[model samples]
Target: MFSDSEIPFDVIQAYLETHYHVHGRAPTTLQVGEANALLAALHETAGVACSAFLTACNPFSQQLEPPRNLELQEALAESLQQRGLRFIGGIGQHPANGWPGEESFLVLGLALDDAKALGTQLGQNAIVWSGADATPKLLLLR
Candidate 1:
């Protein structure tokens, strides 16, 4: 079961099932609703109580050309950089589904309100947010 949202049920399922892989030192994968020890450690190491995994590609889940998606992702990265936010590259991959892996970012220390605002501003349907508990939750925007 999933929360009520404009997003399709199947799409929500895909989101929950997707592996959100974070890169750089201490690479680890995050799963929805599951407490990740690595993520908890990362939060401690990064000195952040919260983080968000988000992408600017496939606005509202509408598939876009690879080049366009790449452009959007790069823009998102630039936006974060401009804000001076610490972030790590990530990818949301759902192997069970045929959808391609989406490039995302694990933005450290982004508050819930700010994360939601950024996701909305980027036209994303949802984002994965984790608190101090380090359990990722799918937050629908539409």
Candidate 2:
């Protein structure tokens, strides 16, 4: 479906089918194009109209060692903290298995432009973003 990306079609398919889990007091699972009521409530509670699901692992779809991926994720978290952004740890995984779950963050109130910039900065091909609609969309950056 995401044929425009240089990323392989199968990889894009995996992204579309993967579950993006947000960890918090009330953990939530996000699926692309599916409206999440809990996330909607979260937006309301946080007084934020949008959020972005981002990861620094496997940059440009090049698989990295688990330790290195974790280190990159830590840096991403630190960067968000330094920006004074509210975020929750998360992971993106395909339910059918095979692909390793990627460590991610659900950054609250991050704008679309900022999300794209961050994804590009992290050498990511894409990011999952949602607005007040609470429906996650796969946004290609490359």
- The CA lDDT of each predicted structure is 0.93, 0.93
How many clashes in each structure? 0, 0
Candidate 2 least-lDDT 10 residues: 1-10
Clash list (residue pairs), candidate 1: none
lDDT of 2 by residue, 13-117 (tens): 888899999999879999999999999998899999999999999999899999999999999999999999999899998999588999999999999999999
Please, what is the TM-score per model? 0.96, 0.97
C-alpha lDDT of residue 116 in model 2: 96
lDDT of 2: 0.93
Clashes by residue pair, model 2: none
